[model samples]
Target chain A: MKDALAHTHARIQPYVHNTPVLTSHLLDELAGATLYFKCENFQRMGAFKMRGAVNAIMQLSVEEQQSGVVTHSSGNFAQALALAARSLGVAAYIVMPSNAPRVKKEAVLAYGGQVVECAPTLTAREQAAQQIVEERGATFIHPSNDLNVILGQGTAATELLAVQPALDYIFTPVGGGGLVAGTILAAQYFGRNCRVVAGEPATMNDAYRSWQSGTIEGNDAGDTIADGLKTQLGDINFPIIQQGIDAIILVSEDEIVAAMRLIWERMKIVVEASSAVALAALLKEKTRYAGKRIGIILSGGNVDLSKLPF
Target chain B: MKDALAHTHARIQPYVHNTPVLTSHLLDELAGATLYFKCENFQRMGAFKMRGAVNAIMQLSVEEQQSGVVTHSSGNFAQALALAARSLGVAAYIVMPSNAPRVKKEAVLAYGGQVVECAPTLTAREQAAQQIVEERGATFIHPSNDLNVILGQGTAATELLAVQPALDYIFTPVGGGGLVAGTILAAQYFGRNCRVVAGEPATMNDAYRSWQSGTIEGNDAGDTIADGLKTQLGDINFPIIQQGIDAIILVSEDEIVAAMRLIWERMKIVVEASSAVALAALLKEKTRYAGKRIGIILSGGNVDLSKLPF
Candidate 1:
């Protein structure tokens, strides 16, 4: 796992930013912990999802590359895959929900992805992507379920751990489990005393429930402002998450917004509500993590300025 | 001038952020120049003013340090002085206009500065600061006119030039002329071919008119969305400005707001309208700077989010 991660880091080094690690005296005082934020929000395509997308596309064979790649996503991953494919000189087919924001669709197109909109449902998205794969003979790359993508996502944690080896905890927001699983793998491979922790919105606490019940659980209604963490854990990444993550912290919608505002106002950095969940989780469990050195993955900075919650 | 700037850089090295240089492919495509942003908005107290404040306070003798320091600013410099003084374990007296934003006043207090509110006029602010100086024997540190403050402000450009010495131009928003004058000195000393340019709001184009007429000019009514760049150049900094600045570009209020939005949305960084003026000026003169490497000073990020123009 360590060797694979190191290889991924080397492969993606040229294509992505190493992204700076930022600290705040005010944030440290608030959380009562020494915090190191890995600013992947400043990543290419403005998200850590770019890391996985690039990795997945890079692993394709010459023939597979010629055939191109496809993915079904309406979020950062959609833009990530498009940008990664564009950088790697491959065709990309994006299957986005019809109800997705026009801004997001335009962003995917701007990144050179051929967008194929479908009914705003999982089944419809999968069907559209399947049709693309069948017609073009392109390989379908799952956003987070693929082994290569998970290995790629782990590189962020690897870089963080490489710099701050003595971190007591590493926090990441749980979505399709790609980031948390990758973080776990990196911590397992490189960390000295670091334990991987997952932060989930209480409104969509599937990951938290899944850990407690020892089974995968989906949210009854994905109604959180943390739009990134709405998806449930997948079979490919769930077992890794279950084994690697020390705990899953759940935070309210208000907590998520408050944390987001704090980062924007105090740190003067634009981070999405999903990215704020990691810091929110740490703030929620301030007593446990007080005075400890911790790392947080700021997942992305892609947010619509018109609809700012603050 | 170079020796003084070097000394100021070393003196304030432990007190302020060296700040990151950020670039955007989209922004580069929009402006013909390759724009490198020296992000002083990310500096301590969220402004480049911190550098000047720290340097000015550090230059004081033990007897003067015991007497403390005072400044009259209703903007970023007030917070900068307060924070710098607190960091150095010295008392700070801030004279703020009575109409200053509650948030700005709170920030000054939070930084351990004693805020004295007076009428909303330059004369009133100076009178209040004078009162503090007379009563407490505090040394008045002019926001941008003092030689020490100007030397301190030059350190940002020094750092930027040290890293990218071959830059063709450096853009800064001009108000009281400290930043532009300091940048000119740094470029003269450190840069190979870099020239310093000033950006000012058309509503308050004192710097631009002053440069054209070979004399200091003051705005009749300081009215601009970029509240920071409304002040006129002073005696101490005006001569330096005349000697050092290559050009001063004037931008409209609408242009300033549009540029500010572009930076907020694309760069995912919270920068005040004053910071945006530098980019607006570059964009306005895109043809001249085509394919050139240019550096822009993002003056500050301390803004009232509730009153955001975007």
Candidate 2:
């Protein structure tokens, strides 16, 4: 898996941007750690998921490529898959809940995704995606629960290490776990003694609890502003996470909002709440990582301006 | 004046960021033009005014530098001067209106500017600044009217034209006239047949009227979200803008907010209302420059998230 990181990166290089690494003196001073922010928010569809989305779609056979890809997500991954599949000249069928924001649907549609609206339920979305797969012979790509997607997400960390080779730690927010799993893979194979840590909402800490229990865990409370991290971890990314991830740092809602505000005001970048979790986790234990070079993967910058916490 | 642009840019290079030039496929399609955005919003202190602040402070003699610098501004220039003077190891006295937001004052103080509070009136702010200059032997640096400041602001356009030569037009917002004047200077001196255009609020159209009447004009409407562009042109920059600037495109408040939102949502970057004025101006005349290369300077990204118009 480690050996194939570079190959996967190369395959997606043409379709994804080599997003810039950004830093801020104010954020560093406030957090008490030197932070190198991997700005995946500037990715093609405004998130690092683009890398995984493109990589997964590219790994398909000629017949599979023509059959196209399908995903059951209304988040960043939906837009990422749509754009990625379109870039590869393949059709994408995005199974989105009818209750999803008009903006999200329009974004998926704008990216050439064939939006298949379903009832506002996971079963409905899954059923719609399954129908597409059965009828059109389309391959279903799990947003963050697939090995190929994890491999693709690792490239962001790989690119980060290439620029700033000797980071003390790489931090990412734990959602369905592709980004963290990918980050851990990068740290294990490519980093210079670099460890991988993750941030999770305290209210939705399935990944953290799973790490503590040495097995898969689930949290039913989906009451977090970080709309992306509510989903429980998948079995595929869990074994890899349990093996290599250093720790899962949990942050409060206030902490999350504060960190997001700092990134917005101090760094002057638009980042969604989920993206700020990694920074929140770092700042939570700034004493532990004081003065050390840390790489924080800013997951995405998709936010509703009207609902800003500040 | 044209040749001086490079020297000013080189001098301020150490203090300010060589901000990235960004382009958006979505924005390009919306405007029907090839937009090269010089992201000065990413500059030190989160604005392009940092360039002018550093340049103006750097122009002082050893005696003047030792005596320190003073400015009356509650805007981005206050933070810019504070950081710039501090970077140069000089004391900065920023006389902001007492009624100004505490956040703005704290930003200046955080950047090492000595805050001198005065009544919320132009006369009081100026008097307080003049008193500081007389008593402390401090050199007063106007935010946008100064020649050195204009020269420094032009460096953004210089850097833009360097990376993206053969631009047909460079669009900038006319505030106190430093940015546009500097842009015109860069166009005349360094660009390859490039013409400089400006954007102004329809209500605060003093700069536009000044260009048309062949003399300096004053407008006191001041009814616009572009707080930075409410001021009229200065004597020093007026001549330069009159001679070289191609046109001043006026846009409504709704247009300004729409353009700003587009940059935020599409480009995934935070930009202030004044920065959006340039984009609004370009979009207003999108058909005129259809499919042509146009450079735009996003002046800053220091918007108050709480008061966002969207």
lDDT of each: 0.92, 0.92
Which lDDT tens digits does candidate 2 get at residues A197-305?
9999999988999999988898875689999898878989999999999889999999999999889887878899999999999999889889899999999998888
Model 2, residue B267: distance off in Å is 0.8
lDDT per residue (tens digit) for residues B1-310 in model 2: 6558878988889888999999988888888889899998889888989999999999999899999999999999999999999999999999999899999999999899999999999899989999999999999999888999999999999999999999999999998999999898898888899999999999899999899998989887578999988788889999999999888999999999999999998898889999999999999988888988999999999988889998
In model 1, what lDDT does residue A9 have?
A: 93
Most accurate candidate by lDDT:
2
Clashing residue pairs, backbone N/CA/C < 3 A, model 2: none
lDDT of 2: 0.92
Q: Which residues of candidate 2, in runs, are more than 4 Å off?
A: none
DockQ of each: 0.71, 0.79
TM per model? Answer: 0.98, 0.98
DockQ of 1: 0.71
For candidate 2, the per-residue lDDT at A114 reads 95
Evaluated at residue B199, the lDDT of candidate 2 is: 94
